[model samples]
Structures are given as C-alpha cells and as structure tokens.
Target: MCKRVTCPNDGKPTWWGCGAHIETALAGVATADRCDCPHVPVEGNPRMFEVKKTEDQATA
Candidate 1:
C-alpha cells in the first residue's frame, strides 16, 4: 500500500502561499495522516468530496 499524500492547501513550506490552506492541511494531516509529509491521501482517502446538489446549479 502507498502512503497518504499532503494537502495542496499547505503553505508552511514549498512555494509558501495560502496560510489558511496550510492550517487546514495541517489539521487534516494530524487526523487522517493525509498530509504529504507523512501520508498520501490518494492512497486510501476519498477521491471526491460531498457537496449539496441544487436544481438551479445544474445547467444544460
């Protein structure tokens, strides 16, 4: 099995951007170890997230 990856939101290192994103990434990493430094999210994490569907949101 592969290790979970890090979050793109991370700003602590690398290019150095989006502090809020980094914070969220840090927290996610702590819980599911889905962060890049330790785990690779693609390994065992959900590929997609849940979002509310709207009738008007859909377009032809």
Candidate 2:
C-alpha cells in the first residue's frame, strides 16, 4: 500500500515519510513543505507524522 502526506505550504499530498527529512532533503528550504502532490520519499528521516495524509479518500 502507498501512503502520502499533505505539505502545509502548498496544500499538496506528498509521499508518506518524515516532513523534516523531506525539508532537509530540499536543503532546508520552505519549498520542501510545498512540494508537489504525490511526493513519495525515496528515503527515511525524522518528523514522519508532522503532516499526514487525508482520510477522505480510500486506499485500494
């Protein structure tokens, strides 16, 4: 099953993973929080559940 999280910046569902890690991966840029929708993290990091996926949709 695939999971995703919402980037509070741009209001998009990024890949499920650590938000801080994603932020750091983006070189500590605000854009990290505003990543495009469906942003799947290729690696792991801290702050995994800072922002989470919306429960409005059902997974297959």
Candidate 3:
C-alpha cells in the first residue's frame, strides 16, 4: 500500500493510495512516478492530525 495518497475526489485521506482517485490525481501531476501522486503529501491522514513531515519529506 502506498501510504501517501487519498481520495482526491472526496478529499478523504487514506494510508494507501485510493485506486480510484490515485489515477485521477496522477494524471494531474506531471512528475508523478508510477502510482505516485505529487498532490498527495507523503503524510498520511491529517484530518485533525498534524505532522511536520511525511515519509518523502523525511527522505528529502
């Protein structure tokens, strides 16, 4: 599971990329790799949850 994407269509967050919305978001991000969606912050859930960095951000 890709813990860096969500249902962009509904704005609902997910630990794994939502198969339905991922493709949608992926099309929008020019730099997205494979199923990676650039719009998807490396941080997972954040509804009332706040984290300074996501997995990708940490790597960077």
Clashes of 3: 0
**Candidate 1: residue 3 lDDT (0-100):** 26
lDDT of 2 by residue, 1-60 (tens): 224455654565444544545544444335545555453334354434344334444231
TM-score of each: 0.19, 0.26, 0.20
Where does candidate 2 stray beyond 4 Å? 18-34, 37-60
> What's the distance in Å from true for residue 21, model 3?
0.3
**Which residue pairs come into collision in candidate 1?**
3-40, 4-39, 4-40, 4-41, 5-35, 5-39, 5-40, 5-41, 6-35, 6-36
In candidate 1, stretches whose alpha carbon ends up further than 4 angstroms from where it belongs are: 1-46
Better of 1 and 3 by TM-score: 3
Which candidate achieves the best lDDT against the true structure? 2
lDDT of candidate model 2 versus the reference: 0.45
Cα lDDT of model 3 by residue, 1-60, tens digit: 334445343333433443344345445444433322234333554322222344655476
Where in model 3 is the C-alpha error above 4 Å? 1-19, 28-32, 35-60
Collision count for each candidate, in order:
10, 1, 0
Where is model 3 poorest over a 10-residue stretch in terms of lDDT?
32-41
